[model samples]
Target: METTGTRRSLAWLVGIWALTRVVLLLFVFKVYAFPGPDVTSDVSVIYQGWYEVLRTGTFPLDDVTWQYPPAAALAILSPALVFWLDYTSAFFVLCFAADLVVLLLLLYAGLRSGRTSRGAWVWVVGVPLLGPTVYARYDVMVTGVAVAALLAGARYPRVMGALTAFGAMLKVWPVLLLVAARRRGSWVWAALTAGVLAALFALAMPGAFAFLTFQRDRGTEVESLGALVFHVARQYGWDGQVLLNYGSVEFLGPYVDVVSTAALVLSGLAFGWLLVWRLRARSFHVHTLADGAFVAVLMFVTTSRVISPQYMVWLVGLAAVCLCFRESRMGVPVGLVLVASFVTVLEFPVWFSHVVASDGLGVTLLFLRNGLLILAALLAARELWRSTVPLPTPPPVPTESPRLRETSLPS
Candidate 1:
């Protein structure tokens, strides 16, 4: 009876959160106003230069308009046929659709777990007050597909592969989940995904091969904790440049860069090592794949030169997934990642600009936020480690056959 009352209280809290979020969304649309955009981050700017290439029957290159990969351009351009130059409203539609996709994926994931209600709760609450992701960026399209693929691991992994392949075309991270899927029949499907991705990339853009070769020559900017290095280099009076060839930054302290490079390499190796461990042990489990993806996401956040705010959608969605399935005590990470997500945005667009305008308080608050995220990730890591070792496994999932399936996720 006590637990029931507590759950009712929590459910009420969730309801209020959802209600406030809805009110906020209306405020954004009607009262607050989107403020749309001025040239800086305008809708046209997103598909800015890509249109020219499409018109000319060619692909972009040489950092000209920072042309994204061929596959990404297709997504950006697809909406244009219907919405035309109005990418803003189109973006809103895309974001809304992404939310729907997330809901479907959540529902499917829950059904596989034999916990449909749990999945529904996750889907309903996982969304934010900010409306949809495509409102400001098209990354949500990729997110929808990537998350669907991973979550579908519970029911239909092959379908997951197809969806992940589509997402990898939008952004490449979904492909990494394959590394964790080593124990299941992921490799075979992953190979098919590779073929589909290649064909799509080539077909979408006439200069797909050239674009691939061109990307190898570019690098990312400093963001996330990686920005600490950039800050240090600036304090020491050094010019920073991207070294795309090595997938890192250059022109800072050669020694420091070397160390960063080494750290980055070690990180990649650790993930590879995990994959090898899973494959060799033949431990193909759904929770295992989700956990591995969590680790990979952390690594990407900590190591990447650029960490954008929207990326949090991925982490938050996955964390909700972990929570829905009651896998890995994800509530801990969900709390941490939420803080980290907001802070990343506040630091970048907020304080960085404030510092330029000589606002010390802004900078301090931003630093505090960063500190909070680091602390959260650290605590979450400790919890993750503790949760993984000799942890009580969930009950066996029921099926008509009741035989242990190769892609079993404990409970």
Candidate 2:
């Protein structure tokens, strides 16, 4: 049951994780790098907006304000109260430490689902940390919720639903899982998600529902694949206004409408594919959710006119969530995501500049990094499609959950 090497490996892993914590603390505290790095990145601005929100009970109303979903604004503001330090410093480190929360949640989800073996959960921890992208966005927040939701899918549907709903409010993807998913496969899951979301929304504001109305009026940035057409328009010297001030950017080209149409068509197809996948996928495999999420992010990144660096965090976070489940099952895909994460960081900070500088090798590596992510997504999808490993039944919580096996599907 227990071997000396296994014990030694566990000890070493714990030591390395502890070291990671210390190093991250150093990075946050000014020992590993600059003392006062300029707040120039988009994430910095986002944090600034959150800080402002916490300082005063206001969320961004327009592009000038960094308008995010009301629920998300609250989520972002949450850490401010938790850490109680200077916003920037605390924001940076707490976000980093959130990954640790993810790890604990990963284990908790597995344990509740009768998935306590080292093989079942170790990869989730080992692989994501290896990825350089681990340092990226707050996707870990969403992952923590999504995985917890999935793990609760079998026995505690309402609680699962509440988590998923809360995640959807944070970012739109979790909602897709909630709405696009089979209604009865996990009604308790859906109910819980919906309840959690409703509760959060109720607490956010009486007018919080109104904030959701303004998103369609918002702007899309140059980060998406949609920006490619904007670039071509500039190349042709078209003189239409590129973007409007409030939220959405408006670009002009002879084929601008056509490209928009194409983007919609492609995105719709991708969405449709996921819908079909939901229909076919019966297994509650965590990789199933992770693989699908990766595909969704890939579709968005490739087809989106705005691919913000923070977006990578979303995919990476979900990938890490999947790894938690994977380690309990298989190990390889976790390794792939981990490698992709490193390549992602390597390519982004330094390599992105090189590609823009017209270095063909830089472009090659760029594609390579993206390719690794694609490969990882495909690999995980294959396993999800092939492996019908049913979701583990959750034991009862003092709070009741939606029943799993009794769920029925839409015809």
Candidate 3:
């Protein structure tokens, strides 16, 4: 039976979430009437354009902004299931459905664990705190797949692998979840599933490999952590110019290439750190796996040259999954993530003009947001390390031999 506190908490969460969504949707509708040129574009135009291309039996490989993997084609086509409705309405409805699915899965997992309700609380509070970006972009769908994979990882490794593979097709990041599997067979299952999916898509799509080339040529997005360095440097008379490229604000000018290359190097270092952690880890509990996955993803996002506002959805989803385990002691880190996400909304839609100008308030917001992420990343890494490193077994107490016992016995 649910406690009174749980009931009250649930009510509050649902109420707040609903109110936020309504406000965000209203804002989105107003903007759709007078769309502006932004990184995300008008949701209706982007989704409807892709849907039209898919309806013609052709992938959107020719579109330069269509940088997602072919598995994303399904999500693009999903809104069409309600074709009777207009594109914007159907797409928003579809995204809302995906959001609910994630909430249900997190709640079910929390209850089934027979432990604390921290997991459900994280999802209830965290997703909405991310603001409208949660529904505006398709990253929420990928987050759902990742959450499902984490839930099924220990009990059904193959299923977990398949889900992760499907998510990776939508966005390359979900593939990182495969590292959380405990069983050796889980690796094979994951690899096999991913490989098969890749092969199938390659056969079906005309330009299946196009995204790779597109991704390679991309520059450093203006919102990334690395970009903050340039933002600061601009005050010192840096000559870099910010422009829209690859569907994001990017710094293009002298030494921009150098900064981009440094971001890649940091990513490589993060990957190496994960590898080292994996090899040294002695504990493999579900909670530990969730925590590890969160750390890995945090590292990936912080180090990447493009930390989009919607990317917070990925971290929020994984952080909620981490809290599902009673053993997870990530309350502080998760709180930091929540604050960072709220800051992200402010930096984007609220004060975006200041951000573009790299003004004092905008730089300060980015600093706080990025600083919180860095702190969260460090704290999560520390927690995972301490938990996974097995406690040393004390030397076995020396046992007295039977002969010694016999000799010592009273005659």
Candidate 4:
């Protein structure tokens, strides 16, 4: 059923995806060194360490760095599937596969009737913009499932719900994909799938729920929006120490708690706004599912206490889904995210020493990156609210003066 032009476009997309992925693979494989700290060390050292413990039928209960949900163990252990390769190589290969799956899903959705390949282009271009970090973390794998759930949402609510639940278990953000879901079956399936998975993890592994208690004393991360306060304060002799805590580099003294709490309060406000939007929204379209999910994730990510580089993968994935629908109007926000992603790669893994030291370059990168995110959040929220929440009918403008109508001048 594909036309010649469609086939050519699909082929070109795959070609670009292949070319970019090869570059990413080379970086992760150490054939060429990426700048600054080695990003692959997380996989080669930390993840492999976790894999050793997880393969023994237990979580890394003693390691405070083991701060992910129980289902995350699946991702850490998934490298076992390719016994032929080393752990790091296998993990990168799986990440590459996940990336391919997302692109294929976008292409399938985009090439359909009433859809556009712009979404496929977004995925192709956005992933590489974040540089090799796209494959260095497990976030891309989680994003793959999230994209699948969003694309399936319009026609298959139950499938979408199950995938949403699974993706949420893998990482917590994908549950936001259900913000605009109207089908009761989607909610029902989501609840059922989540409950079953929770029970299975709890019964199968000790400390499967331990990650929930691990984040109690976390500090504001250096790359978070709130961290700009300390970044600026450090220049004025604020005595805070940047330390690796909770598996992330964080600001750990002198009002760090205040900024972290402020981030949490902002997150609460964002949640409240989402609840209000869902209740007041009166219009819904097939595209609204993806659009709503995109906005919801944007709200939380911008307000969260940590904005790790991999977080951009989630935004890029959701943005791709939104663009798949011709009716979705998230182009501006998506473009901002793409630009911010490029900034993210610069802030991390490239000049990260500057960021850790709170230097001029670091503060500038965070300012621009976080500023773009805040703007995108505001614009996306306005667009979603205006399109779905209906205006006040503009007070019904008068066609003629009251005096003319009184004089019987009306036709």
Candidate 5:
């Protein structure tokens, strides 16, 4: 009965949160205004356009901005099934459903673990705090895939691999989850991931590889951590231009390429650190994989050249999973991630103009958000390292031989 009551309480919280998001969508943000500057509006236009292409049996449309793998087309065109609703409405509904799926998975995982409701609370508080941006971006869908993969990872390697592969097709980041799998499980996951990815690429043909070329010419997004360097440089007479490139705020002109390259180098270093962490983890506990995943994702996001507002959805989901374990000592780091999520909303739809202008408030907000992320990454890494590194067992005490024991016994 207590378990039932807890479940009911969780259900009420989730239902209320979902309702608030819907209200925000209809009244506050009006995200269904397709083709507008709001990110989701652009996403809806692109998805609807892609749906038309799919209807014509084409793999990818000719738009250079369509910079995702072929499997993404499945998600992009999925809203077409709701014939009664327009594309914009259908896309919002789909994203909302995906958000709820993630919440359900987190809650179920927490209950199954027989741990405190920390994980469910993380999702419950974190997602809504991120505001409407969670629904406005399809990152929520990718996050759902990630949640399922991690929750199923220990018991079901193949399923984890397949889901990770599906997510990688949508966005490249989900592949990081494979790092947490055991050696044998990792191989199985890797094989299935590669096989599925290859099959999807084969089906899409030439268009499947187009995003690679499209991504090559990309500049540093103005809101990225790297852009903050350039933003500071601008005050010291650095010459550069900020513009909407490829549907994101990007820095162009002198030294932009150099900063972008430097971001890549930093990302490489972060990857190396993750590899070291994986090697040092001698034993895999129930929560080890989830904790490792959270650290890996935090490293990836903090060091990337593109730190979009929606990226918080990924961190929020992963952090929730980490907190599901009773042994996970990541409370401080998870709290930091939640704070960063709130700041992300402030940096985006709230004072995005200030950010674009590189004003004092904007720069400060970015600094706080990015700094919190970096701190969270470091703390999570430390926690995982301490938790996973096996302690040396003391040598067993030598026992007396049987004859010696008999001779020594009181007679």
Candidate 6:
């Protein structure tokens, strides 16, 4: 049933994916040096260290950088599946595999009737925009799970629920995927899966929940939306010092806490807005699940205290899912996110020194990237509301009496 043009376009998508991903694999494997900071150090060093600790039947209890849920141990330890290779190499290979899985899922979803290949195109194009960082971090693996969860949401609500819970266990953001779940089974399955996973991890690992305390003293990263205030203030003699805190470079001096708190409050308000939208929504289409998730994650990521470059992976994944549905009205937001993804790379490994120094180039990149995110969030929120929430009833049109109407017509 596939047309020649469709087949050709599909081939093009596959080819582009292969080429870009091969380049990414090369960069991650150090066949080619990437610019700025070595993003792969997190895998070669931090993740390798945690893999050592996790293999000893425990989490990294002594490391402040171990700030993920207990199930993240599975990700750190996944390299053992490829024991034929060294740890770092194996990890990069697995990340590449996860990226492939995501692409295939998007392709399957996009090729079906009532779906377009825009989602596949988004994944193919957007991932490369973030450069080799796509394969350098475990976030790509988490994103793969998130994409599968969204695509499965329409027909297999329980599967969606289980995947969502598993992904949240991995990175804590995929829980937002359930924001627009219409089936009660989805919620029930999610609760049961999360509870079971939490219990198992707590029993098996020593500091399964310790990540909660690890980030208590963190500050706003230089790339976050709220950090713009400090960036500009630094230009005007703000005394805050940027330092490596809690495993990420952040502002640690005066008013940093205030900005961080404001970020948290913004996240809180975003959540409140989502709840209100859900309550007011009267429409639930197949695409609404993806659209709502896209809006929800966008709001949180934009408002978070740490807008890390890898966070763009999550946005790109959700935006791809949204585009899979022909009826989804998230095209504008998705385009903005793709652009932001490019700017994210520019701000991170491309010119990261500028970002850390809060120089003109760094500030420009962050402002452009974060501003796009803010605009995307606001626009996506608006579209979701207009699409799902019931519109106000219009006034009835007045009609003339039959006698008057007949007389006027005769005249």
Which segments of model 4 are wrong by more than 4 Å? 394-411
lDDT of 4 at 45: 93
Instruction: List ranges where model 5 is wrong by over 4 Å.
Output: 1-8, 27-37, 59-61, 391-411
lDDT of 4 by residue, 1-411 (tens): 468887887889889989998999999898999898989889999999999999999999999988788899999999999999999999999999999999989998997999999999999999998988888899999999999999988889999999999998898889999989999888999999999999999999999888878866677999999999999999999998999999999999989889999999999999899999999999998889999999999999999899999999999999999999898889999999999999999998899999999999999999999999999999999999988997776676659877877899555
Shift in Å, residue 96, candidate 2:
3.6
Evaluate all candidate structures by whole-model CA lDDT and list the values in order: 0.55, 0.53, 0.81, 0.93, 0.81, 0.92
- Compose the digit string of candidate 1's lDDT tens values, residues 223-320: 44444544555556655543423322232434555545654675577566555544444434446666666656665555554455556666666665
Q: TM-scores of the models, in the given order?
A: 0.72, 0.70, 0.90, 0.95, 0.89, 0.96
Model 3 lDDT per residue over 32-104, tens place: 4312234335476777788888777667777777888888888888877887987777777777788788878
- Give the better candidate number (5 or 6) by lDDT: 6
| Candidate 1 lDDT score relative to the true structure | 0.55
- Candidate 6 residue-wise lDDT, 267-339, digit = tens: 9999999999999999899899999999999999999999888999999999999999999999999999999
Q: Arrange candidates by TM-score, descending.
A: 6, 4, 3, 5, 1, 2
Residue range 223-262, candidate 2, lDDT tens digits: 3455444544555565654544343334543666566667
> Which residue pairs does candidate 6 place in steric collision?
none
Residue ranges of candidate 2 with Cα displaced over 4 Å: 1-5, 34-45, 64-67, 82-84, 108-137, 176-261, 281-303, 321-334, 355-362, 388-411
TM-score of 3: 0.90
Model 5: per-residue Cα lDDT at residue 265: 95
As for candidate 1, its clashing pairs are: none
For residues 198-241, write the lDDT of model 5, one tens digit per residue.
67667755567678777787889877889898878877888788
- List per-candidate RMSD values in Å: 10.8, 11.8, 4.6, 3.0, 5.4, 2.8
Clashing pairs in 4: none
Worst 10 residues of 3 by lDDT: 32-41
Who wins the TM-score comparison? 6
